[model samples]
Target: MGQYPDAYVQYLVHFHGDRDYFECHEVMEEFWKAHPEDPRSATYVGLIQIAVGLYHSRRGNRAGAVKMLVSALAKLQPMDVRTLGLDAEELERRIRNRLADVQAENDGYTDINLPIMDPGLLHRCQTICRDKGLVWEAPSSLENDALIHKHTLRDRADVIEERARQSRLRKEQGEAR
Candidate 1:
């Protein structure tokens, strides 16, 4: 049970980040079945549903997307897992954003856009620069440079930690103002 949950969580992160929505659903289903009563289980399930909705949306299945996303939002709306392992607030924010996208599509809006970024590219750039002892002054400029090598797991973790620290500092400074 524990292994399945952990594996599911890993798969969730992997597939969600990679935009493999269907795989995300398949992975999370394993955990959802084992712990239907757990609040976190609902959170994972809701996320998978959201991903599936997104997949449907990309395929131009507007009705299917709306149905799936609405159900997913309903499932997520009652949960209070802000202090849990998952970022509940962010998940809700994403759901709301997706719902808006679906609404726009359904309403015949032609400019509907989704915010999707390539994590692998970002990681690769950061790792390559760090490995070469290159310092990046501007975060945005990192994308302009060519990636020379792939990032090791430890290097990737360090980059993530550094970015988190910088984000916290910015947040604290903003709060103090």
Candidate 2:
């Protein structure tokens, strides 16, 4: 739908279809960066936190999961999220339940489906899922180790190089000053 950004729709697709929470975080973070002044900035951060929380939770990082989900809940407001076509109350309730589960030291991971209130948005996500050969609202594939442990497993050479370059630039600027 034209109502949503491509990155947001991509985020929803990865989030529910493949259950790739890491990818969800990536897409939403890009959107947030590109539109820092957008009114939905806070909501975007909350959404990214949700994905990161779920990723940590599924990886059995209870402390990390609890921290991210709590931050997400704190940052998100029902009215603010409603503007993004999500069921704000249900989303809050789900995050709270997930936080409770993480705090209680639940040993298993469960897939969470964001309560998307817009039919058009849902259809758009489903279409994208089909195109990508993924199932909509699929259960977590626990056997997929790459998806489960993406943060630790994925290559970060590019990220490392970028950080180094930024640091070098800052040093150069300071020297000039």
lDDT of each: 0.54, 0.91
Given candidate 2, what's the lDDT at residue 171? Answer: 100
Q: Which candidate wins on TM-score? A: 2
lDDT of 2 by residue, 1-177 (tens): 138888988898999999999999999998899999988788899999999999999999999999999999988877768877799999999999999999999778898899999898998889989998999998999999999999889999999999999999999999999
Clashing pairs in 2: none
The parts of candidate 1 lying over 4 Å away from their true place are 1-4, 37-39, 77-84, 106-177
Top model number, lDDT: 2
Q: Estimate TM-scores for all models.
A: 0.50, 0.95
Ten contiguous residues with the weakest lDDT in model 2: 1-10
Model 1, span 1-177: residue lDDT tens: 012245444443443333445556667777678777875676666666776776566556788788888888777644333323334556666667767877786543221212223344334434544565544222212122121111111146766899999999999999999
User: Distance from true position, residue 32, model 1, in Å?
Assistant: 1.2
Regions of model 2 farther than 4 Å from truth: none
